[model samples]
Target: TQLLEQSPQFLSIQEGENLTVYCNSSSVFSSLQWYRQEPGEGPVLLVTVVTGGEVKKLKRLTFQFGDARKDSSLHITAAQPGDTGLYLCAGSESYGNKLVFGAGTILRVKS
Candidate 1:
């Protein structure tokens, strides 16, 4: 079983600033996913990186998978207040397998 650990349990930043959150594990994973959850709502998928050293961009958000596939990071450029929420990272050992989730990072962006 792979155990994912996320850094910075909580983060508070001002709007328009930039920040990065990380996910790491000792065991390798086939794929890694990032999600965002708001109050009273389920986590919303942001991106998934399957290839090592791969990077995906969604608008102002950037997701990158480590060269070893054992780590990942989410970077937000010019963060906004609307981006405040819980960010979670999950790893899948293989296709069709259950994902192991990290403890999550709480992000609070103030305007």
Candidate 2:
């Protein structure tokens, strides 16, 4: 079983809405990654945070890693239909490269 925790198993929002999701874990990791997956395809890594208290942004999406290295968060601004997908958070112990992923959060953005 995976070790990470993801909140909001499903979310639906109108275009232009802003939303946030979270991933939490009690175990410390060397790196944490966020991914977005579309139907019938593998997920695309959105960002990877290797340092505690790190933050990264891609267009309207913002990602943050907790200072304790055991949690992370993703925030989307001005949601669009193109942003609809399954969002997953994964973590790996220091350089182990064996990822443990959360159950995924399904987001549906309506225009």
Candidate 3:
């Protein structure tokens, strides 16, 4: 099983809408990062939250870190067709340099 698991593996929302995807892990990390990938391209880092209970907002998106540092969530507001892509969460494991990733959440924003 992946060290991190994301809920609602897939999401389809209409444009101008809003949605949220969650990433959960039993293990704790010093920090966690979120990414978005479009077709035929590498994932671009969205944001990294290191402090527990920290929240960051970018444009119409919002991200929150769990108080325990074991989970995180991404919320998109007024979704746009161009926002359709794959969202992923990654973090370093406690034991080694291995970076564990969530299963990945696929988001489709329909126009």
For each candidate, what is the lDDT? 0.96, 0.94, 0.90
With a 3 Å backbone cut-off (N, CA, C), the pairs that clash in candidate 1 are none
Superior candidate under lDDT, 1 versus 3 = 1
- Candidate 1 ranges with C-alpha deviation above 4 Å: none
Can you write out model 2's per-residue Cα lDDT over 1-111, one digit (the tens) per residue? 448989999999999999999999988988999999999999999999999999999999999999999999999999999999999999986765689999999999999
On lDDT, the candidate that comes out on top is 1
Per-prediction TM-score, please? 0.97, 0.96, 0.93
Count clashing pairs, candidate 2: 0
Which 10-residue window of candidate 2 scores lowest in summed lDDT?
92-101
How much is the lDDT of residue 59 in candidate 3?
95
Residue 34, model 2: Cα distance from true site in angstroms? 0.4
For candidate 2, give the lDDT of residue 58: 96
Ranking by lDDT: 1, 2, 3
lDDT tens readout by residue for model 3, 1-111: 348999889999899988999999888887889999999999999999989999999999999999999999999999999999999999876566667788899999989
Q: For model 1, state the Cα shift of residue 19 in Å.
A: 0.2
- Tens digits of per-residue lDDT, candidate 1, 1-111, equal 789999889999999999999999999999999999999999999998999999999999999999999999999999999999999999997667799999999999999
Q: Pick the candidate with the highest TM-score.
A: 1
